[model samples]
Target: MSELHDEVLRLSGVGKTYNPGTPLAQNVLQDIDLRLARGELCALIGPSGSGKSTLLNLIGLLDSPSAGELYLQGRPTRALDDAARTRLRNRAIGFVFQFHHLIPAFSVLDNVLMPLMIRHGKPDAEDRARALELLAAVGLADFAAKKANQISGGQQQRVAIARALVTRPALLLADEPTGNLDTRTAESVFALFRRFNREFGCAVLVVTHDPRLAAQCARTVELVDGRIVRDAANTAAK
Candidate 1:
């Protein structure tokens, strides 16, 4: 396959500006050019207010870019309508946020099955099997029947990861996934991302402020003042 065909994501001169036509308009991202191939593990690092969150939001299809095109799984997203964007995002991208966001009332297994249930009302036997498999992979099989709120924060985050992967998305976008965890817990959560990337061949892009966690990614992209200042491979990735 051609290089383009191998890429799971591509941003061509992508830019984002809030309140675009007003004097109060603030440009959050500019001339952002990037690409991630299948199974590539990359870390996005930048100082606060450097636009990392905005960039991830755009890439995750939560918002549209104002000045350029973004292609996800080779499909151009600039002109896609809201419904189309939603559909594509659900099918091609998975997300893990700083907060696990699992419903407190739901069982751990139910949380993992949420995505599938959203895509197709009421998960079937196969869906349950997949959820159980993911829970086991994350070492949470024993907690499957417990309420999400009953688990520890780190365990909840693992449940979130399992939920994100249930769809088998082509790209996984994780925004500060381990920001609230302790050092040891953080490392374990980060490892789950690497494991899933290798096993599932999904392109992984994680935004993290932790240098230790960032160093583990194979590639790193640094953003500053709304533009990428550096994007390079880590020679000593763990």
Candidate 2:
């Protein structure tokens, strides 16, 4: 494992409260402090209602923290405006959700190129080449011409991983990315995450419930009742 000093994502005393100032107000996370270093593969695991997703959202820059500060690439993000946050997120973060969220109408290649297209108008040959390279990396080069919906669940998730990598993000966040797959398939997908983290030197934070899956990561952070309970090295079981 790398030193914590080389952190990519850092959360200090972070907290989140929803619907503040109303009867529905509820605190979802409390005093969360964590750090993810480049090339690190960490697992965020907790039971239902443990605020794992909330914490992930906060770190991914998709939601703001109610307290404390979050640093991405060593820059404090508490004061960044929406446009600044969006630009920072686009340049530094990649996300994969439980659902692949690929457009069924678009071809797999186009789906992988979505991020690049959003940043710049049309995809040039270089962009297309990178998209194809990612597809090949995910073992889906042949599926590039097919519509997203034509692929299997596992294949679609692979495409999502490729799409996430298209941006060459420094931090990759995945929430239950393998939740819908069979055990074997899930292992395969998880392996791909490990491969990419090593090859691209990106920090990965994945939320999962399976102990076996969590065990595969280099570090694991456990949350319960909106608070961090444990953070430790995996120490792979013999």
lDDT tens string, model 2, 131-201? 99999999999999999999999999999999999999999999999999999999999999999999999
Error of 2 at 66 (Å): 0.8
The digit string of per-residue lDDT tens for model 1 on 1-238 reads 2287879999999999999899999999999999999989999999999999999999999999999899998899999999999889999999999999999999999999998988989999999999999999999999999999998999999999999999999999999999999999999999999999999999999999999899999999999999999999999996
> Residue 2 CA error for candidate 2 (Å)?
4.5
**Candidate 2, TM-score vs. the true structure?**
0.96
TM-score per prediction, in order, is 0.98, 0.96
Which stretches of candidate 1 lie above 4 Å from their native place? none
Residue 39 C-alpha lDDT in model 1: 86
- Candidate 1 has its poorest 10 consecutive residues by lDDT at 1-10
The Cα RMSD of model 2 versus the native structure comes to 1.5
Query: Residue 81 of model 1: what lDDT?
Result: 93
Residue 78's lDDT within candidate 1 is 95
